[model samples]
Target: MAHFLSESELSKIESEKGKESVKRAVKSKTADVDNEMRDIREQRARLVEERKKKRPQTTDKRTIAEIHKEKREVQDEIRRIQDSISCDAKIVLPEHEST
Candidate 1:
């Protein structure tokens, strides 16, 4: 003979399932945030390396100015990436939507 669950028992079971689903979603979001952070770090490292390699050895005014401009641009990009990392670090799971 098959046993039937009471209303309260069914509700408890559903609540547990919902909790598990939320946990899984949170875990997945965390992984995505970590990946984004890694990518941003890699991008910042690459920009720094490129800036180092582009260092000028000349005393020419125009060349120095161009190098400085490029350096400023790279610095700005790095700053933006840092800001993005900071934002991602503060990520929170969204609330469940009612169907």
Candidate 2:
């Protein structure tokens, strides 16, 4: 005879699978956002260092604006990353919820 899962066991298995799927999707999105944020931050840092070395008094408004924009974009990217991967790591099975 073939083994079969009881109704409760089947429901638990389905719930676990759904949670795993959500976790994987979140991780993939977070990774992409993190990489983009890192690149933008590095570029902004380079621009700041270059400005410090070359221009002591002369201030270019456009360059400053560009750097600010980059900083904003990086901040936005980090927030997006946080939103995507903010799920609870500790998963409690539904069957044990009543206890």
Candidate 3:
């Protein structure tokens, strides 16, 4: 049975479809960002461990400075990716929506 839809209904349907596409795109992008963040975090952890192993007692100024700088860089990267993920957080659509 063919039931005609009003203009408003058709418009709403189109809008919903557009939103769905946008949501899917956002989800995929978020996943990628999340993976990047995870990698960065792992790198940071490794850096920390390396630093610890190098100096179990005395802090070498040059080595400490270099490790600190690297830590800051990794932290910055994590923060940037976190912000990117949160920026699109409003559109992280659920698996399904009930009409």
Candidate 4:
């Protein structure tokens, strides 16, 4: 004969399963964030390299300004990603709360 779980036991198993699901979701999100951060850093490095090269004779103030703007935008994006990661780290799951 198969054993049936009581209500409390079933709820406990469900809660544990939910917690595992949440943990997997969090890990997946974190991995995605890491990949994004890596890509942004690579882009930032490329921008720096580009800035170091000599500009062509036809290069104008507008072009130079645009490059600078792009660099600033990349920097801002890095900071935002970092802040988001830190904020995410601080989150407390409801199921993790102590009674």
Best by TM-score: 1
Candidate 2 lDDT over residue span 1-99, tens digit each: 123345675567558778676566556656777787888899899999998999768568999999999999999999988765654322433445745
lDDT of candidate 1 at residue 82, scale 0 to 100: 100
Candidate 3 lDDT over residue span 23-62, tens digit each: 6655665677778788889999999999999975977799
Rank all candidate structures by their TM-score, best first, as comma-separated numbers.
Answer: 1, 3, 4, 2
Clashing pairs for predicted structure model 2, backbone only: none
C-alpha lDDT of all candidate models, in order: 0.74, 0.71, 0.75, 0.74
lDDT tens digits by residue: candidate 1, 14-95: 5877867756655665677778788889999999999989987658899889999999999999999999887775664334
lDDT of 4 by residue, 1-99 (tens): 223445785566557778677566556656777787888899999998897785545778899899999999999999999998877766754446746
Candidate 4's displacement at residue 51, Å, is: 0.8
Poorest lDDT segment (10 consecutive residues) of candidate 2: 87-96
Candidate 3 backbone collisions, by pair: none
Instruction: Count residue pairs with overlapping backbones in model 2.
Output: 0
Q: Model 3 Cα displacement at 60 (Å)?
A: 13
Model 2: lDDT to the true structure: 0.71
Q: After superposition, how far is residue 40 of candidate 2 from its true place, in Å?
A: 1.4
Please estimate how well model 3 matches the true structure, expressed as its whole-model Cα lDDT: 0.75
